[model samples]
Target chain A: MADPGPDDALFVNEVRGGDQKAFEAFYRRHEAVVYRTALALVRDEMTAEEVVTDTFLRAHAARERLDPARSPVPWLQRIAVNLSLNHLRRRRLGIEALPEVAAWPDEAATVPEAAAERRETTAALARGIERLPAQMRAVVVLRFVHDASLAEIAETLECPVGTVKSRLHNALRLLRDDLRRDFETAQPGTQPLAAPDLGEMGESIG
Target chain B: MTGWPDLARFILGRRAGGDPADECAIHRPRLAELVDERALGGTQADDAATTAALDHLWACAECQHEIADLLLVVAGLQRLGGTVNRLEPPPGGWRRLSRRLAAPRPRGALRLRVAGLVVVPILAALLVAPALVRDLGTSAAGAVDAATRDAATVAVPVAVTHAAALQRAFDIGDGAQADPAAQAVEVVPRGPLPDGIEPDGSAFLPGVAVPPMPAVIPQ
Candidate 1:
């Protein structure tokens, strides 16, 4: 778990008192998680960096309101997620496709096959995740990347658990469809993975 | 969607005394919820829902397929988290962020200066230029002065625009900080970091089981 270190509260307290140096300390601690989380959703390196800056900026700007008793990571996560979604929405104005990292799996790991199989599932993520709608994508990232539960995802996205569940459900369904299509495309003559038009299994069907 | 309790109640009812043939129809709608519960390790209390879902899972190929798909999606997400865990944020992030932090806060002074400098000239031009135009009766000087006032009137908006922007920056500070509710709520512990899951976060999610295999596989 990311503790933000024991002095996190101290830094947050100092930050609330208008300490720039302390705010820097706070930003340094959380930047990686926030950046990677944003990257998982926004899929662009620079935009993910922008999201981190915005998250900390928002955190710093709102620093005086920071609760010294709480961990600031979730708050930071909330801001990063919001900024990522905003970037995604604004990027959609240009209707851009997701860029691939393509540099993954450079060295083979020596983990067990179960671990390896899990990696295979995630190997499909960067591609399949690109096809998800921004909201659903946010839910997916919060669940897996941030390791947040449905309720935590709801809080991060500021929606109800039901909405989280629904988005996650549809997001998974869409990802499954994309995966199936990809798997079928690889095969010689399979009838496109036979569970016809699971698109209707979207929330409308639920 | 048929919410958990309603669906669970129906499923439980069907399991108790309902027809066997209708299992798929009764259970299919809530398949997503069932999958989420299992994948997330049934965080919510079960109304014997997990048992009922599992019982249904072994008997139904379509349900098995759907559940398998959802679990794979969850596992994919879990793995995505692990993959991203290996990455570091670009170097000197704090340097760029510190630069952002050093940016000047929205002081009302710029707007004040804009109002004082621009508004004064604009008012002076508007008030004096008309007299010049009226008194001089189309003289070149008056015409020039009146044209200047027209330009000044158009220019007044620059201050107003800046004023609006500065106000928004202020609102971002005041309005967003109003509730202070975000961090106050406790994030439920994620349980434990599962295998293949790195403790990448400073204290991100430190909870729960590894992604599980689906109860039954579809042919």
Candidate 2:
């Protein structure tokens, strides 16, 4: 994670000093990112909500231990990610059910044909992202989704930068191949069908 | 915009006609390397190595397509944050956290709470079980005694006139055993059971069966 901004740092210090308003302000600033990051990993709304609750609750409980110099985003994000992963493990959901194909809504400005193609591509990408393993998905979300740098992701995940790179490479490689397979074999006009054996992709990527 | 569209068009265009099997084998990993660097917004590849990889990427149409596809994928991934934030927990979700914070926290509160849960149920069962069991036993005994009495007192042969009635009354076959005469004794009710009569059946006597009665309707 990047360093916390001066105002955010100040809030952390204030929260350590028992300022409820400062904590609330800090929450308001970072909650959306934390929630979005959790939803990306867990992909369930209610579980993600619980993750948000737990993440902030933990941050508040350990307020004195939080360093004002560090960006609280990574700290909060790591908690949400861990909790979301644990939720998935407890469910033994093994692999998630892929999202249903998104409809290509008609828009006035763009050509229907182009819009449909883009929509299909977007849906495929979304599904591919969803299919990544929990840890790989976390790396992808931090790197690609939130635009975290390699060093920042390493700091957040508490892994080596090389590990983050390998995971990202493996994740993108599988996602690209999966999406490519879908596009190649898809019925030309309809939504892409769910392919079987995502486990096979995981092995090949690994 | 120029490189972006050109990249998209060439990628989405027809694959270059050839035996892709061998060429794909060689370039796929290299393209993966370039794309990984590009995806991370930087390349660990030094300038010379970077230049050589880009040269090979431009020269190979398959590599171009792979790089193009990955770049598009990166764009889509970058958009995910915005798209996903659409599902952000609705405003004031913090109210739950705020409520939790406002609640008092004593050390070991969680352990105390869990222990309370386990202990309370066991304690309750200990306190309440005997009375509950006694009440239930008395009600069951009274029902059986009343049913057996009603079955025996009817003047008609129970199997003939009241098989259904007896079954309904005693939940058995005709309320008759093989030696019905020996088991049953005719009890003449001195009168209709007196109103407000309550049976205290706590006292047990051998060879004297006291018909269990219903609770008194207190006057």
Segments in model 2 whose C-alpha atoms lie over 4 Å from true places? A1-3, A93-114, A188-206, B1-30, B43-46, B85-89, B104-219
Chain A TM-score values, per prediction: 0.77, 0.78
User: Taking the tens digit of each residue's C-alpha lDDT, what string does model 2 give over B37-67?
Assistant: 6678763454554454454555676666666
List the lowest-lDDT window of 10 residues for candidate 2 chain B: B195-204
> In model 1, which runs have C-alpha deviations exceeding 4 angstroms?
A1-6, A95-123, A188-206, B1-21, B29-31, B43-49, B103-219
CA lDDT scores, all candidates in order: 0.63, 0.63
Q: What is the lDDT of candidate 1?
A: 0.63
Q: Write the per-residue lDDT of candidate 2 for residues A71-170, one digit (tens) a residue.
A: 7888888888888888767756555443343211122223344455565776777778767788998898888657789988988899999999999988
What docking class should model 1 receive?
acceptable
TM-score of chain B of 1: 0.38
